[model samples]
Target chain A: MNFWFAVFRQAGRNLRQTWTSQLMTFLTVSLSVLIFAFFYLIYTNMIGAGDRLSDDLRLIVYLEDDPGPEMQEQLRRKINNFDKTESIQFISKFKAYERFAEQLGEDSDVLTDMPKDFLPASIEVVPLKSLRGYNQIKLFSEYLATLPGSEKVQYGQEWVERFYYFTRLITIVVLLSGALLILTATFMVAYTIRLTIMGRHEELELLKLVGATNNYIRTPFLLEGIIQGFMGSILGLSALYVLFQWISLHFAGPGLLNLFNFTFFPPMVIVSILLGSIGLCTIGSFTSIQKFLKI
Target chain B: MPKLVHNQDPIEPKDIPGNTMIEMIKVSRTYAPDIKALSDISFTVDTGELFFLIGRSGAGKTTLLKLICNMDTPSNGLIEVAGYNIHNLKGKKLAHLRQKIGVAYQDFKLLSDRTVAENIAISMEVSYKKPRAIKQRVRDLLEQLQLTDKHDALTGDLSRGEQQRITLARSVANSPRLILVDEPTGNLDAATTERVMDLLTRCNKAGATIVIATHDSSIYKDGNHRVMELRSGKIHSLSRNNR
Candidate 1:
């Protein structure tokens, strides 16, 4: 028989012999990968959502007093000089009041008795795509607040900071779970390989006695570990893809998640994860086989 | 101290007549501190000699055989087999040495679940023999021992004599440079024993060095070969067959 063929055949036999436990080991690794990928997907989309929100970032410069025509032109030029603008609009005090009443709807009566000049006029600035990042917006807001007739500049600073930190936390979780997946995959592979060695103790000894090389004897077991890692990663990624598709389809319309625009891992990333997991399993298998077959 | 026939001029395996296939100098094996199995005994076998180790139950026959194959380490001494010093052998070197040596166990150490053909083919498979060649060799070995009908039978399902023949067949399947047999006829009938001996004799004549460790005198009684009789973990006498 071809040496490789026999080695794989032996591996198949071992897997079959301990199939119940082997299946459990496989599932364990898959679920670990699933958990890791779940967190990773969420982390990626959160960051994507954060970036998307930044793309639509608008900073409003509220004024203490309305500027004169010449002063308004001067303020516009100052804003332009600060950074490029997609569109700069001057919302007058009346326009601001109208918008507030429209937003309140039935609650408009609560603001009906308020003075017409109650709301302050503001200059709404929507920065260019490249200048919409948090730090850029923060710096631009600080600069805008100092503008001639500007009272304060705001882009819901508190909310953006909170969301940024939230994504940072998810990044941490993703990294932690990634390390966890590595440990789980390698440990499960090692445990399974060790069990197979124990079960075939007598058979292995006979093979050794019959002049089988350590390489020959352990090739099948190592192949078993590698196959387990490969299958587990594939299963986990497929499940994650299914989840991504279901979420994408069910929440297709505009919603909070729609802002996320979920994207599954690229093919390259998937291949890397698969190869990485296989590498971990190979280490596990090699170490366990070495420990058992010291001769 | 048992008589030792050490190599005066050790030579390469390719060299002629006086080339010692096995050279042991004051070999001793002890278990757990002081339980001597084979003590201060030594001997040498020529390139193609069929040698016998005769001893009673505790006579250290099996221990001596184990030491020769590097299965058990001697508490002290050097064992050189086919030119490799087995005492310190390891890794690929040890594997290479074992690949050239075939051993039959007293317990008929066959994979009970594997078929007779597979059991014999293992020796060849470990050496990377082609499938067709392995199949043909298995068939030939089984046929030689009158076990052609039992080719597909699991070793566990075979009779004692059949298992014995299968073990012997497996040991010589690779055409090893050395063959070590322990209790070759322990489970064999008279006729089966005769057939097993014939096959071994044929292998010996074909130039593989042979070592048989047994307590059964009937197997080596009238054979023209060297015999080392052991008593209580040491050699009692080393003599050539008189008949």
Candidate 2:
């Protein structure tokens, strides 16, 4: 415990002694962490939005003309019995025709000229929440088409599938990029700390001479690196929070916020980022001090 | 005391008697292919004995001190200090060995950024001495070394002689079993040299093994302690005073 206390005290001293170098290192690490957090927020938000979109998806199944009411009831029962179907409701031919007429405009004669049963009655099918993909929807629709009364099965909004795939791709890219950024930051922190240790080479030699262990000497440097990383993390998190607030205040209107909603990282994510930066700095200092301690 | 052998074989620390504090057998240190710093060196220093290694510059005096402290390893042969073989020592064991030892370099390697008191306290701090005890010990050492008034002075701002005293104070702060001094009085005046030697003699009387490496004839002329003169890395002669 005493050794650790001494190490911490030494680290504080180091910061005071070489503020300029320490500041530069802190800023570099903060910038790296900031970039990582930005992408991470985007990836998380995208996944969240995708989940909501998936739950609201609906599949439309148009029936052959004038299937008896009893057949429609059987089809509904069959859809409900299928594990993938969450809910199913029938839309009569008249209602479907009226809805299309409204879409075509009130003055349009297209719907008025058609026969009473011209538009096919349809079943609006909501699949299970878990089945939310282009392939899943296509497979479910094909199953519907093979049924007794379904003339055509159409799941609207092809764009949602494309968006899901795009988000998945972004997730993969963000993960790789975040890993690369952290590794690079670790090496940079290590190099900067190596320079700090070099500046105190004489003191280290003296410490060794005075029966101080390699652990004792290295602990201070390790602690120094960790502190630098922690400070950088705090600075980065604050900057990110401020930027989020600025965007939320200025560009928070309907269309803009919908595209990329800006929000502060949740409590858990913030804690992890803080701890991760500290851990990274520790690794960096540990590696850099090896060569010097070997001497 | 264990017998010193000239054979180039690793000596087990257990083979050495408990009373033998430092034992080196056929120790050879070579920097490179052609630079043979110390070759075929063999010696032993008993517990609580004051030994002096007399040699000119580059005579491997510093190298020998480093080897004893496990700061450097021998190219061949064995070095046993405080019941641990130096060649095989590493990590915690090596550090433990050094904790019982102290070395005052020829050049005073004091922390310039720290005050004289901090420099002295470091010696005890490495040993994990309590803060209160460390403070008292530093106070006692500073008073003994006549550096009491310079406790708050920066080491870098002090004169060479004062810096040398601070180095000595730091070495003995933990009351180590073996104290190694290299030309400690090199920058001191006659009065200061006497005072410094007196402090070392007092430490010796307290049962600490003392090894003083110096080229000064005044230290060995009296033959107060066992003296070994190194002529180009090999021990030329060994003698002791008729106490």
Candidate 1 lDDT, A1-295, residue by residue in tens:
5567678778988998899878988998898889998998898788778887887679999998877788888988998998998988888898899999999999899996898778999999999987776678888899998987788888999999898789889999999999999899889889988988898888888888877777788889889878988999899999999998998888888887767777888788789888888888888888899997885
i-RMS for every candidate (Å) is: 8.8, 7.5
Measured with DockQ on alpha carbons, how good is candidate 1? 0.35
Comparing only chain A of model 1 with the true chain A, what is the TM-score?
Answer: 0.78
In order, the B-chain TM-scores come to 0.91, 0.90
DockQ of 2: 0.34
For candidate 2, the iRMS in Å is 7.5
- Fnat for model 1 comes to 0.65
Q: For model 1, how does the per-residue alpha-carbon lDDT over B1-243 read when each residue is reduced to its tens digit?
A: 111121321223564335778988898888986788888888888888999999888889888889888888888988888676876777656766787788998888888888999889988887778889999999998888899999999999998888888999999998887899999999888888888999899999988899999878888889789999999887799999978
